[model samples]
Target: MNEPLRTLPSIDRLLGHPQVQGLLAQFSREAVVDLARQVVEDARATASQGQPVPSLDTLAQRVARLAEHRWRAGPRRVINATGVVLHTNLGRAPLSADALHAMQEVALGYSDLEMDVEEGERGSRQEHVRYLLCALTGAEDALVVNNNASAVLLGLAALARGKEVIVSRGEAVEIGGGFRIPDVLRQSGATLVEVGTTNRTYLSDYENALTPNTSAILRVHRSNFRLLGFTHEPPLGDLVALGHSKGVPVLHDLGSGCLLDTAAFGLAHEPMPQESIRAGADLVFFSGDKLLGAPQAGIVVGKRSLVRMLARHPLARAVRIDKVSLAGLSATLLHYLKGEAVAKIPIWQMLSRPLEGLHQTAHKWQEAIGPRAQVRKGESTIGGGSLPGETLPTWLVALSAEGVPGGAKELARRLRSHTPPVIARIQEEQVVLDPRTVLPDEEQALLAAVRWALGA
Candidate 1:
């Protein structure tokens, strides 16, 4: 074998060179040596490969690229395009600007995270959002955790572990990430007492299933599906009464938690936590991010005794939310506390944005770049996993080339590649822009994306 060419300079020699020394001076002493060595090694490696070795300036450029990458912040932001509102992949539920502002105010350099500033005494972090949740949901007491699933888990662990939790077979579900009811119960040390058939469960079925071993009448909402005709289940109020009569608490897991009566927004009815409490549920658990338009949290609200029990659970601390989440959630709840700014919640705003308004927005988008694209009336979805069958009325803008056979693919690929990329759907051979998740101010950038996506 040929002897290895000795073009590589020692770290001392490289830094001693006048040109290298100039570049070294730009960096701190420790970093300068390391950066200088990397540059010289890269140059030698190229020469050994029979390629013309790069000059010091070119090496500097290469080093600059590596340095830039090293310093760049990560877990970088991505455009949400999958059309799932509460798109878990893209970090579900974008917080309102006010919520973001509130988080910024308290996220760094703590203020009163757990201190009664008014009394100058230590307070509980849970106290921050307790009153807000109770006020919003009309509950006797409330507590929040990192997520609704955590709230459910803690509740089960605290109340029903080692005892039976009676639920409808049809209502047992695995939400999002393969988190099944049975799995959760097993982990919580609770026994699963599944009652009734998947399609038909009755009040009597629930009543007969209750025994001395039953700790709670657990009613899990069939969030992912709905039963049509010939379905019979006990009303929530009746179930609550039955559980009370049996001397057991009634626990309802309103999974895919919704706060507002979605029916008013032209969607199916999702049981509100407050409604569950009002209907006499001893404990109610739901997600804060879903319909509440709050930060990612699992809110538990019901009788004060149950709430206290949940808060005292050892597992509750493990699933507890951070101070930032509490601050953001508090700000969001404050909007609801005022009782007038419910419309300001981002999720509610997106849900209640009228079809006419979407069409108008589409028209504006089309007007800006319609000559190079197309606009069509289409429907978006209430993604996240709620309202599976209901297709929200929406508007779409499509763009195509001059008879390019795979224009949709070409446009989609380019849009996904763009900085601050655009996400849309491909339907009937056209790229469709759904306005459901697109903010009003983002319309201009969206229009620009259509143009860029098509290379127009």
Candidate 2:
């Protein structure tokens, strides 16, 4: 073993090899050295185990394989075969073509992200989309943050820090990724004053909770789950009136933001930002990625004074949205202004797509993949904690390989590892793909990937 360990090539010798040198054009010298170190470590470990030491040529092959793996491990695109629209793990919202183009335009060059072009002076980055958001949501002013959680944190810290913030016990919820209202308030330096029981809350409860130290009343929408059969909560107008009467602001965090009336698409009606603004809520926060169908952003819209206070807060600078997200969000909002969001945005398109269209897609996939694939009626969800207990009827192309080695799991792995990976769900020992979320242009590639997976 010691004899084979001596055969291991030195670091400088490996770095000078043709293959390693070729990698330098694509990867940094430091990165190449790091990868070379990993390969040498692995070979040394094998030799220590009394296994045959790999030759220099074999180590060079290892370097090539390792380099490619590192590249592939970085962010790469994958087809969303899983029916969870707005899939959190899949980067939440897929950008519209216009949004992608807008990001590219800004990313390639600079175009006054935080400068007033006409005035030739430094300006606010929020100006890029502030007017558009205000026009769409009917807010007096709007502010953009990195995400919804940050929006809430900044709002509380600006308005209620060192004061009591009243919230219903029922709305003191822990959202996805363990983000809780009470925890956020704690971070904002605001004291959380819970009112009423977990099942019910009344306007009287909030009124009773208000003190001279109370600065704001917080209303959190239950976006991820529902409390039915006896849940009673104060309406936004009622809370706004109560807060205003006490000289306190009301901040409503509508976790999943919806610009349109979802009931128009036969889905449950979620609270819209415009409705909150109209109802006189002093401040409102919502997510840009969820139902808004844009990049990951948290938008704060409300009375101009309240929003201005938030913008001036020191935390606002720490949680502001980046230029790429700002550009994408601006482009997405433009679709609503043009009265074409339902037809233009991918999330809205999938939500409003006719059942007949999905069935047609499932049939096409079934035909292309042969008997191994079955076209069946299935259900897709408006995932990302937007609409709970409401499922969109979808059609699925289900694949089965019961007799094959490793069965359905092996088939799924092959498709996942395919070039431009195809991600699907497994149910009842079969791989299921809901075409409702798949783009029509991706059909051929999906079929080829499936055929390869099943050895058809």
Off by over 4 Å in 2: 1-21, 46-61, 72-74
What are the per-residue Cα lDDT tens digits for candidate 1 across 1-456?
224445444567656766656656666767766776787777777678887756545665656666555645664555554445666666667788889998999976776988999999999988998888887778899898999889989999999889999989988888768899889999999999999998889999998988889999888887767678878888999999898987899999987776667898888787778888889999898887776777888889899988899889899889999989989988888887876445677777787888898788777877888575566766666766677777677777776655555677877777776666776677777777777787666666776776776663
Best by TM-score: 2
lDDT of each: 0.78, 0.91
lDDT of 2 at 108: 96
Q: After superposition, how far is residue 63 of candidate 1 from its true place, in Å?
A: 10
Q: Lowest-scoring 10 consecutive residues by lDDT in candidate 1?
A: 1-10
Supply the global lDDT for candidate 2: 0.91
Q: How do the residues 96-198 of candidate 2 rate in per-residue lDDT, one tens digit apiece?
A: 8999999999999987898988999999999988999999999999999999999999999999889999989999999889888899999999999999999
| Per-prediction tally of clashes | 2, 0
